[model samples]
Target: MRMPLLCIVSAVLCLSAASGFAQGESPPAPAPSAAEAQSAKQPVFNQEQLDQMLAPIALYPDALLAQVLMAATYPGEVAEAVTWSKANPKAQGDDAVKQVAKQPWDPSVQALVAFPQVLVVLGQDPVWVQRLGDAFLAQPDDVMGAVQRLRQQAKAAGNLQSNQYQNVTVQAAPASTASSAPASTIIIQPADPQVVYVPTYNPTTSYGTWAYPASPPVYYPPSPLYYAGTALMAGLAFGTGVAIVNSLWGDCDWGRNDIDIDVNRYNNINVNNRIGNNQNTWQHNAVHRDGVPYRDNRSRQQYGRQLDGASQRAAFRGDDAQRAQARDRARASMDKAGIERPATSNRQARDQVREAQANRPRATDRQPQARSNRDNPQARQTLQNRPNNSAGRARDNAFEGVRSPARTTALADRGRTSQTLAQRPNASRAAGHAISRPSAPMRRGGGGGRR
Candidate 1:
């Protein structure tokens, strides 16, 4: 008995030792923390992706391109401006910026209204807009560098050049005491300061040969109707001239890899004291971002902190009350300035005007009537005796297929009576059948007898 007990105890100890060894060899991993998981999921765009995003607009004139880069950072406002542009198609150039002065959009976005075609293109791919904006906000230097690289390729290919529409200039970096000289800068400016022409180009062909096979550049062509009669020769095209004086206030500060604002032009356009008197460099306004969530952790930490609770709520909920007030204020301002509010806003007034015009007989109508009377006196005499004429009988029978108001009312009344009879609790089966069945003439002819 003692030997059997010893063997069993020895086996139990051996099994316990194996279980401890197994646990020591492999332990379950702890679940990832929230921050760690989020960081892992956050998308990070590389140099190739940045190049792809910047390719389409990289060749734009310096000022316009700078404003575009700035406006892109506010995707939400860009979307709103797009909708506004579509609704108010006639509103463009300096006047348009002034008309929308009271609008609750970023100054950068407001400046884009002068180029409605650009907004139309931007609005086409909202996903691309958001991604580009996020990329710009996350990596300003990389984005600017990508633009420079693309411009160099285009310049080398002879596609980008000084033309009637735009002036392309290359500025060599000043000689440095250091071992390496700084790189040359490519600057594109509107040939005429007062008139700016937005350039449209095929990115794939314009940039000599695209380097990135994995990520091809996105090309958004301007609407043919928008740029009608403008020839696309040598992979570049220009839309109609947009006469803008002070709407464009930002310029590309390529050396610093950022946008610089012309304080005088900025002040002239952005009334209401939005910016400081001496502030020259363009800074991203978080308030105008309108609650668009920053894609990267860095941008979120940088700009997201500036938003208040109300602004955040407005971003999600559409800010209905605030928008109404803004519209009212805008209308008042436009009225004061003698700038007509967009036809979309005054739809009711337009309808009223149309109705009045339709009701009031015009001189043209009387002229047609008199001309007809002179040409066909017999018809005029026949009209005078229309009650007795065969034509009058035909005219009376013209509406024979349409039920008159009295007839329609009688039919409706009959329907209601049948419904009332059907609803009665004590109605007999025979009465219900009479109410449900159609008259003999109305019923379709079928079997003569029941089986």
Candidate 2:
């Protein structure tokens, strides 16, 4: 009994030692939390990136620039506007905006048709447009600040100044309680209130020595067609003047980091998007976003909820219901007229059709009658007795009084010189005329003569 007890104790001790050894290795790290994973995926643009993105359009007229920033938020609409602009290249200025008033694009996007050149530049680089829009949506203040910085740099470099196309005004930033306002505000406006000219410039050179070497400014020049007959100098080139009456209605409110609407101009151009007298500040309209996803979690949380499945379906439900009603009415009319029609949704009707088809005799399934049928002697004799002059009869009927010439006639001879004098009465005269007529000059080259 003592020996057995000692052996059991030894086995227990060995098992305990093995278990402790197994527990000694380090455990795997805990999985990242959902928030951490999302943060890792989201992109946060820095000041340099914002500057790079806004460089191309930073110097645009205040009202046009404001509309562009507002439009950028709806990248999908921007793309549609690009396509529309390309399709209707001749459409521009206030007239163009009025023409697209019925379009489903955002008011800002519709207004952009006034300057096809701007849309051309925006469409050239889709990725840039998307990123610019994302940056604007995520950090409005940062984007506005970046624009100011670029404008300041251009002004300091003497590249940006008052010209025939636009008037540049620089004033000390108003003493405001809000810290978002800049030290100085630069406002650019069209020289003529009615005619707005889009400026074309190389962002890199116009802004002087670019500070961010890692993220250089993107410079997309407008097509020469936009600036035809207009002199293009070194610094900034103004394209053909776009005569706009009220297409441009939004103005950059630098102090508030938002856009302010000219209610009168807005109403005039956007008959459909007119706002109340009190509603002067421009707000982002998610309905015009058209289901485009936001880049970051913040924007997604803010505007993404505005468009739900129910609302999206509601957009088409009215038209669908109307169509369904029309179809029902048409079917009723046909039924009253004693016309038979298949029920679109009835499986039984389809099955009946298939059954009828299956019951009908098929040509392939019918056995052909044997060539030596004993009972068809009379029918065979009738077929044999039928005359084989059917073609001749048809020809005689077609040409009642006209007789066909004999096959052995001189007219049927292949040889040009094988006819007697009577048959070839005019043949010698025709030959003399052919000999006298000039033959076409022979083509020299082996290749098929000029097409």
Candidate 3:
């Protein structure tokens, strides 16, 4: 009995040890959080959309353009911020940044005070501004790369006519060189160091050389890494020979408009100042510059921190996208209180004038003329009694669109010696014509008209 008991005890201990080893070797799988799943399903920016959005700013110097894009992300704050900037025009660069640092605005907007005009243009459309912000947040690196590429492509196509911004005007180098994009270097001393001019060309028609294989022409940059079959030129040449996907394609208003902003409340604005308000459009995965999930300090998370689970994610108010939204609420409050707007700019005046003009008809419409000459009996009589001679009939029907052919057929029969006016060959007896003698031009002394 002792021998049997010892054997069972030893076997039990061995089985227990094996179970512990198995558990140690293979850990349990982790279930995915809702945030991870949501981030995974987010839409990424396709190359074409990115390229189009970045086209206008592509010409801008890197640092300023960065501020412009970031400001564009917070479009709602733009008007108020622009108004404030105008109020304090002397405060710029570091000084402007300091003034708005404590304000409850997005860091992007705070940084944008130095550039009021960029903010103004971007503020015109809240939706586009939000889209650009989402795209930038989702893929900053990709967006930057696309910007560089379009500039290079424009250069290669000789679209970059001149470049004072880069000071890279020289003899054309191979495609590898940055200066190769411009045709020639014609340097001029800029009058204002504050201003820079960058000449551009039409991307559609000017984008040189393509492969036309019985279908639409396909354009590609002179790069071997880019595969031949890729949809490289698909955006620029859809149906037409060349597509104008440059600034002309509603890409960006790439001009500087330094005007005073009239501080006023615009009541007609949605509370959620995002492109579509839902936020997850081109939001994509949140991979930071360092390729990790990191939060921005000047973000909207402060308000949203009061929530839990999916609600917290939905309450993501830490980014410029959220902080900028506060401007909308502020604007609505001002309007409801019935505050009068400040002095308007030249642009606002022109816009108001245009609106007034669009609502009313043109000044040239004062004289009430008949829409159709066919309504006048004299006009019909003139067409019907037209002489059969080519010159006389041609002069009479010059202004007519659909003239009666019955008159022509009747006139044609009058010239025929064998056939009467009713016997002329005609399509439905209306359009047929017979040759007729020309009416003699009246001499100076003649009182009667001659047939």
Candidate 4:
């Protein structure tokens, strides 16, 4: 049986109520053909498509990417989980997921409380996960721009409809023309990053009625306005979003902690036999997933590397075809960091991270505060697992007398900061500032912790 054209193509084109596709007055640019994505030798993406690909998680830092990736796998519970997280931030990792145990969401859905926006988008389109992951690796900064622009485009084309995307139109100053004084941009503030309310207008009034006896076209906030919205969105909402997601951040902070890349898990999903898990692979994933039907030289090179000797003239060396593909990818990545994706963590990304980390208190300075009496058997046990208070006479935790397990568990990331502090007798008493055990972030409070 033949599949429908819209089914095989973009979710945006279907315009069904479930898809939440907004129908605008103008005839859109022709949709890309199905084969253009499925059969191309390489993937190609324009700025617009890339922007769409990156919308969900572009505003997130590298730290939260892992959780978003994992959480996006189960979208239905995203809203409940986010709401619950706002109420209970201290619950972390395993504990965090337990709160929503009866919600009937996948266990994975519980992990996304801190990343509500990602959850909402995943709820809208979980398949977009592959693209969100790819974009984070290649262009961290552009993530925010991509999110705003797509909504703007979607609004312009009348496609912003979904649980996460809302529409709002308010009367504001109009765009400046030579005849009229320029107007200050109208920034439509987001109710939350998880919910984007686009500001649009009936084009007939704004641009004057045209002769075409057609439906009134809707004009989205302009591209410049969308770009401005990106900044406004981040300035206004990213902080709250990050605070919520911190309950999950203990495991998700990829750059801060050691990431044991499940080489096999990642490879299994890579499907296309690509070489090294680098920026090139990220691009390859983005291009191919979007169905551009394009596979560039880098992808070919990575696949070629899977051959016996790679480029070496050894007995197991790959054939001429593999060598050619690898060479092609190598050349492209040489000059500009854009398309010529490399086979490792991007240098620019790494440098930005390094600079950012430089200001943070060093692991040595930010030692963990472990109880010195830990070995004395009288150490305060974790009350975290205790049952509801005992009017009914409930017992204390069985794991009693154990020193702070959270301290030890949390220290594993910060260069064993807890152990370092534990070794020095009452270190904070002398330093005057208690090197508090990096606690599970509170759901809400005046905040402080090592980033």
Most lDDT-accurate candidate? 2
Instruction: Score every model by TM-score.
Output: 0.57, 0.58, 0.33, 0.23
lDDT rank, highest first? Answer: 2, 1, 3, 4
Model 3: worst 10 consecutive residues (lDDT sum): 240-249
Ranking by TM-score: 2, 1, 3, 4
- RMSD (Cα, Å) for all candidates, in order, is 29.7, 21.8, 29.9, 37.1
Error of 3 at 374 (Å): 90
The collision pairs in model 1 are: none
| lDDT accuracy of residue 142 in candidate 1 | 71
Tens-digit lDDT string for candidate 3 (13-114): 889878977888554469899998877655476666766666545644443465556555444565567678767755654456656756655544665665
lDDT of 4 by residue, 1-451 (tens): 9978777675544545434434444444697788875655333444445544544333333334444644433333444565565566444333444456566553335545434334334444433554444444333334433433333443445333222222233233333322222122112323453332333233333222322334333222322322333423211222222223123321222122222233343343232332454521122223222222213444334432333455466435554677878877777777566553434458877876777698778766644434344433444454444567764433444333255677655555576776687678587677687565765766566656555
Supply candidate 1's per-residue lDDT for 189.
96
Q: What's the lDDT for candidate 4?
A: 0.41
Candidate 1 lDDT over 126-163, as tens digits, reads 88998888888887777777788788889889898998
Model 3 regions lying over 4 Å from their true place: 1-23, 27-42, 83-104, 168-451
Quote the RMSD, in angstroms, for model 4. Answer: 37.1
Better of 2 and 3 by lDDT: 2
- Candidate 3 CA-lDDT value: 0.46
The most accurate candidate by TM-score is 2
Model 3, position 402: C-alpha lDDT score = 39
